[model samples]
Target: MSTSTIFHRVAFIIGGGSNVGMHVAQKLKTEGYRVAFGSRNPDIATLEQKELFPVSVDASNPESIKSAFDLVRTNLGEPSIVVHNVGIHFQPPVRNDPFSVSSDTFAKSCNIQLALFVAVQETLASFRSDKSTTPKVFIGTGNGLPFLKNMPPFFLALASQKATMYTMMDYASRAYAPEGFRFHYATLVGPDGGLPNLDPSAEVGFYNSGPAHAKAFWNLISADVAKSWDYRFTYAGEPLMT
Candidate 1:
């Protein structure tokens, strides 16, 4: 990005330490937008010379989240974009039946997702100025009700919470669209074993077909974005795009 384009707009990315969040940050930065990455691990925060700020934030704690936003506002100006992507998936080692699931595990997952939506709204309300500069929120998916098929009904607490947050997000978008806040969600059908513009041949255990699937999924979603429809849960274990 040229010096003239640097800091033209700003974005706040939650869970921006690794993977998709990091890729999002790189994309935004390449486009000349200032970015701030929020995470519990400050040490691993993605770095930029001046346009990126690494903030220590526990997404599950409201106060910590609030403080992180305050720091971002004080340090990076108003961020127009917010991407929320924080979650966990545990196997049998963590699960002990629906009744036996520890409150901490359940609440942590639920609260983090909920807190992200709340934090974004609060941050937008607090940081936005009268002069608009392209505001958008792109949340990572995997919480839709359709993704819960064949699973125990009780296992849906996290999904339920995510659905509620997205519902709230929809309302916020409609209510605040005049103010320039746009909301979007991206759902992943499976893991991203390799990244775009990388050497897949050197990637160990990488599915030879994974990159094709990723590109296809992105293309399908981009087409969805063009048509301006709310992409919802899957049908029969297939993504809505499929």
Candidate 2:
């Protein structure tokens, strides 16, 4: 390959202002890949890298997503890869039991997870061209536990929603592979991996422990990203092909 030949590499990160999304953007920027970081609040998109394009995006809205994609196309051209890091998990709606799960709570959990799914779907549909050497979609999974575990009431809702989203992701990957759209799912289980220390809960001893476990998991995530483009691994289990 000639040095002057542009690789046309770009990564669009949903919820890019904080958490794993920011870390992933940093990693990609370090490797010389163009990064478009999206946040519901545009002010949150912050990074020192000149190549990083921080934009406002509402993951749940199709029009908002299209606008983000359009902006990227105009400024950075079609992204070679897309990473969705938008999902919320808090102790709120404090579930007492499965039987107590409310319709409103369930909808909130599902909506949050489904938003990422819609973003990925729209992104895949917007690929300017199918003729590229590197074309992939990395959808970050917020629920990292195995499929069989009995999660807390709120988490049960979260996990089921993630599973449903992954099912769609699998079909989309299979459906689009012939046309050069590749979809990959990754479970981002951690409390800290280069997110700004804005939340005091993140500094607490108990909250920090989960992320400590997640830190080791990130090593696996690095290896997974490097070793294979498509595969699935439970946060607590061995690697398996998607």
Candidate 3:
């Protein structure tokens, strides 16, 4: 260990302008981690940090992600954590036409929600390079609509992509855990089954407060050992997976 080396734990939050993303960033800062969040839109990405960094990154584009990580490495050192919070949605059709998957919807979901290929490539490059410490990676997600029964057609298209994402995340967590990396896929269930199969009447759910979700996520990231918190769903700080 050279005294010249500076170790500042950094966490980058993608889509960090969202309600959930903002809270997550705030929480990470409180936990003493340098944070950066990327947004596609400049308007919402306006949030700046005196000590932290923010950049423009299109989740779909590997070049954009690579560029952002490059800057992070230069400015903040290799990121010890990466949280993918980007999301995409399509409005449900009116009470008439059946739900149809549009090419636009499919592509946008791949770009935003799944964040396709670039996301994983950059994560391994940045986090896996330094094996002396454990690197944490978490993807914020919602309950898979496709796997659930009795869902409305309005969600058909979105469900297809999200379900695929869930499965892929599962595989990633399993494959990477064998190494010294911590990979997590936390699916949130909000009020009124907001994202998936949830009872509208259930109180004390994940939506109880935005900070609660952030706290739970932080707990997973800061855990002493990587538990099965990855590949799990949580509601109000409770892990749904045993």
Best by lDDT: 3
Candidate 1 residue-wise lDDT at 8: 35
Residue 205, model 2: lDDT of: 33
Tens-digit lDDT string for candidate 2 (1-242)? 23344347777887664545666666676656778888887653244344577778887566787788877767776776677655554334545565366777667776665666667665765564635655455555434433435455555655666676667667776777677555655543323321222355755332233332233224333443343333444323334333
Candidate 1 residue lDDT tens string, 1-242: 32333353777777755455666666667766777888888654237553467888887777787787777667766666666666554332335455465666677777776676667666566446526535344444434443345654455555555666567656665776675455544443333211222245645222233333233223333342332213332212234454
What TM-score should be assigned to candidate 1? 0.68
Q: For model 1, where is the 10-residue window of minimal lDDT?
A: 189-198
lDDT of 1: 0.55
Alpha-carbon local distance difference test for all models: 0.55, 0.57, 0.64
**Candidate number with the higher lDDT (1 or 2):** 2
lDDT of 3 by residue, 111-130 (tens): 55445456766777887665
Which prediction has more favorable lDDT, 2 or 3?
3
